[model samples]
Target: MVGSGQLRLLAGTLCAYERDGLAYELQQALVYVDDLLVVGNSMKGINCLKSLLDKEFNIKDLGELRYFLGMEVARAAQGINICQRKYALNLIKDTIFLGAKPYSNPMDSNAKLYEKCGTVFKGPSKYSRIVGRLIHLTHTRPDIVYSVSHLSQFLANPTNLHYQVALRIVKYLKNEPGKGLFYPSQNNTKVKGFSDFDFDWGSDLDTRRSITGLCFSLVTPSFHGRVRDKKQSQGPQQKQNIAL
Candidate 1:
C-alpha cells in the first residue's frame, strides 16, 4: 500500500492498488484520521477492499458524501456542486456585515495599497481575523482570492484603509454566499494552466515586488490556484531560476 504525502496534515493516509487480472481497474482508499473513503470503478472491487478493512477495523459506511470539512457537496446527473453557503453566512453574520451593501467587485482595480498609506487601524486583530476568514473562504470562492491575498500582506501592520477594504470583501461575499465550483460528471482529465505576471512592475510599495497569478484547471473549472507577490532572489543563481 502506498501512502500520500500531500494530505499528511489531517493524518491522512492513502492506499492504492491495481487489480491483478484487470489492468484497467484501480482502487484507492483514503483514510483521514478515523474517516475512510473507498473509491473504485467497480463495486465488487470496492466492496472487497472494504470487507478486508472491516476485518481489521470497525468501519461505518456513510453511504454518499454530502458534506466534508466546510464544503457542501451536492451531486446531480450532470455534475457535482460544492459550496460553503452556511460558512459564508456565519462569517457575514459574525462580522455584522449582513446588512452591508453588496459589492460588484472584490477589490477596486484603481486602488493601490501601501504599508504606510494611512493611520494604523485601532483593532489590528479584527482586520487580521477577517482577512484570515476570507482566506479560508477562497477554498471555494476563487473570485475573492486575489483580494484576500492582497490583504494578507498587511496582516502585520494593517491600516484603516486596509481594514475598510477588508470589510468591502465581506460585503462582496454577501452578494453570493453560495458561489462555488462545479465539476461535471462527464469531463476529461486533461490539466490546463493559465498564468499572468503583473505588467506594472514593483507594484508593492513596501517590498517593491511584482505579483504573479496562476490557475490550474481540469478541462474548464479551476481546481487549484495561487496569487502571490514575487520577492527578489538573494543570489544571482536564484534570480536566474526565477526568470526561467
Candidate 2:
C-alpha cells in the first residue's frame, strides 16, 4: 500500500514489519505523498500485513483495492485494468473545456510554434494558473504531457501566442475528454525505457533546451521500458516552453 502525508509513517512501519519478518512473504512496498502501493504473491502475506495495520493504526479497509492515487483499478481474470477517467473529467471541468469541441490530436501537425518576441500577455497570471493545473493533470494523462510541458515553458512571461496555444490544448482535451492511458492485463512483464534527444530543437528560443518526451511500458513484473524524445524533431515545434 502507498499513502501521502500522515500515511507516510504508516507505510514506513509496514515496510519495517515486512523487513523483520513480522509480516511474512512480503517482497516490497512503496509510499509516496498519500498513496501506498503494496506488492506480494501470497494471500497470507497481504492479510498478515493488513492485520498489523488494523491492530497498530486506525486505517480503514477500503477492500479489494478499486482505486488508488487517481488511477482507477479493476480486477479481472485476465489481470488488472488501470485508467484515469475521473481525473481527466475533473481537469476538463476545471479548465472550462468540458463543453468545447474535441480535436483529433492534441496538437495540429502543421502548426508552428515560436516565442512571440515582442508580444505581451493580457493576463499572464491567468495563463500561468491554467497551465499549472494542466501540468498536474498530466500525471495520469500522458497524451497531454507534451502539450502541457510545452505550455508551461511560457509561465514566467506568457505572451498572447502562448495563451492561444494553451487554449488550443484545452480544446484538444475537450475533444477527447475520456482519453487516458490504458494498462492491459495480458502483456509481458518486462520493464523497459528509451530516451532520445532533439538537438537544438529549442535553439530558436533563448533557452535553447530541447524538449524531451518519454513513454514507459512493462513487459513483466520485473521488466519495463521507456521511450523519450524532443517534441519538435517528431513534428513542428509548438509555441510552448518549459521553465527550467
Candidate 3:
C-alpha cells in the first residue's frame, strides 16, 4: 500500500505479483499521478490494505474510481470505456480553438513549406515558440502530428513563410476544438506499423538528407497512433503518411 510518488511503482509490483499468482486477495489496483485505487474481492482485504497506506502516508479514500488523468472510466458488464472528452474540451478552450471550423484532414496536401535562399526572418523566436506549443498539443491530437512535425524543422531560424504555416495550424485547431481520440468498445487487436522515406526533400537547403516517417497502431485495445518526422526529406514523407 502506497500513495503519491510510490503509488505507481507499487501498482506495478502488485500487478506483477497478481500475474505470477503470488496474491489472491488483492484483486485490482490503479495508480494515476498522486491517486491510488485498490479493489479487492472482500471488504476486509481492502480495508486492511487501506489502513496500512493510511499509516504510511496521508491518504484520502476516493471510493469508486470514475476519472484519472483526465480520462473518464466507466465500468459495466460489457467492458470498460475510457474517454477524455472533458479534457479535450478544456484543452480546446484553453487554446481558444473551440469556435473554429473543423477540417476533415489535419493539413493541406498541396502546400509546400520550405525556406528559400536570402529569405529574412522578421521574428524567428516568436514563431518557433508558437510552433513548439502546437507540437506538444499533437500528443493527444494525432491528426496534427504530421503537420506540426513538418513545421518544427524551421524552429532554429524560422522564416516568415514558416510562421504563416504555423498560424494556419492554429487556425485549424480553432475550427475543431471538440475533435479528439475515440476508443470504441470493439477493435482489432493487431499491432501494425508503416514506414516510408522521401528522397532529397531538403534539396532547398545545404543539408541533403531525406526524411523518414514511421507509425505504429494497435488495431485493437485502443486505436491511437503517433507520427514523427526528421529534418530533411524523410520528415515530409512521414507527414504524408500521417495525412493519409
Candidate 4:
C-alpha cells in the first residue's frame, strides 16, 4: 500500500490508507514504536490486514481494544465505555493525595485565577508534573478540562493558589475514579458538535494581553486558549471522520 499509494504515512508512526475490502472509504493505523492499532470500519478487514502485516512484521492482533495507552476500554451490547480508572487510581496513589475528600466540582466557579494574585510556589516543578498528569486525565474526564487548562498556565511559576486548585481537581477525580466516556454503539454515529468562544473576554494581567477561551465538544471535549489576534483563533476544521 505504501508503494502503490493506497496507504500514506501521515507522520511518524501514523498512517492513512484505503483498502478495497475495507468497510469504510479510508482506514488508519497508528504505531507506538513497537505496537500498532489497526482501526477501520470493518472488523473482518482489520483482521485480514493484520494477517498480511504479520507476514512482513511481527504483528499481533490483541483482539478488540480493551486497553491502549492509559485508557481502559470496555465494550457491551449497549455501548463502548472508555476510562482512566486504573490510571486515575494510580495517579492518586503516586501523588499521595488519596486522603483528600471528594469534591463535587473540579474548580471553584467564582475563582478568577491569575499569576499575580497568590503567594509564589517555591518549588514549582512538582506543580508542573501534577498539571501534566491532569492534562492527560482530561482525555476521559471532560468535566475537568477547563480547570486543568486554567491551572496549566501557571506551569512556569505556579502559586500556592494554583496548587490548591489543582488538588481540588484531584479531589473531584476521587469522586468517581472509574467514571468514563460512554458512547452507545447502537445509536446513530452522525457527528454532532458544540462550541463557544469568549472574544477578548478579559485580560491576562501578567502579559498585559487580552485572554480568550475557546472550546468545542463533539462527544469528547477538546480545546485551546490564548490571546492571539482574531484571525489566528478560528475554529479547527475536521480533517478526518471519527467512529466510536
Please name the candidate that would achieve the greatest lDDT relative to the true structure.
1
Per-residue CA lDDT of candidate 4, range 7-90, in tens?
Answer: 566766434455466435445676665556678766665555565566667554555666677777766676667788877888
Candidate ranking under TM-score, highest first, comes to 4, 1, 2, 3
Off by more than 4 A, model 4: 4-6, 13-25, 197-200, 203-244
Error of 4 at 204 (Å): 4.5
Error of 3 at 239 (Å): 44
In the range 92-117, model 2's lDDT, one tens digit per residue, is 67766466776667776455556665
Ranked by lDDT from best down, the candidates are 1, 4, 2, 3
State TM-scores per candidate.
Answer: 0.77, 0.67, 0.57, 0.78
Candidate 1 vs. true structure, TM-score: 0.77
Backbone collisions counted per model: 0, 34, 11, 0
Candidate 2 least-lDDT 10 residues: 223-232
Model 3 regions lying over 4 Å from their true place: 1-16, 19-55, 61-105, 115-125, 199-206, 219-244
Taking all chains together, the TM-score of candidate 3 against the true structure is 0.57
Candidate 2 regions with alpha-carbon error over 4 angstroms: 1-24, 27-39, 110-118, 199-204, 212-217, 220-244
Best of the candidates, TM-score: 4
- Our tally of clashes for model 2 stands at 34
Query: What tens-digit string does per-residue lDDT give for candidate 1 at 138-210?
Result: 8899888888998998999999999989888888878778788877788888888999888889988889999
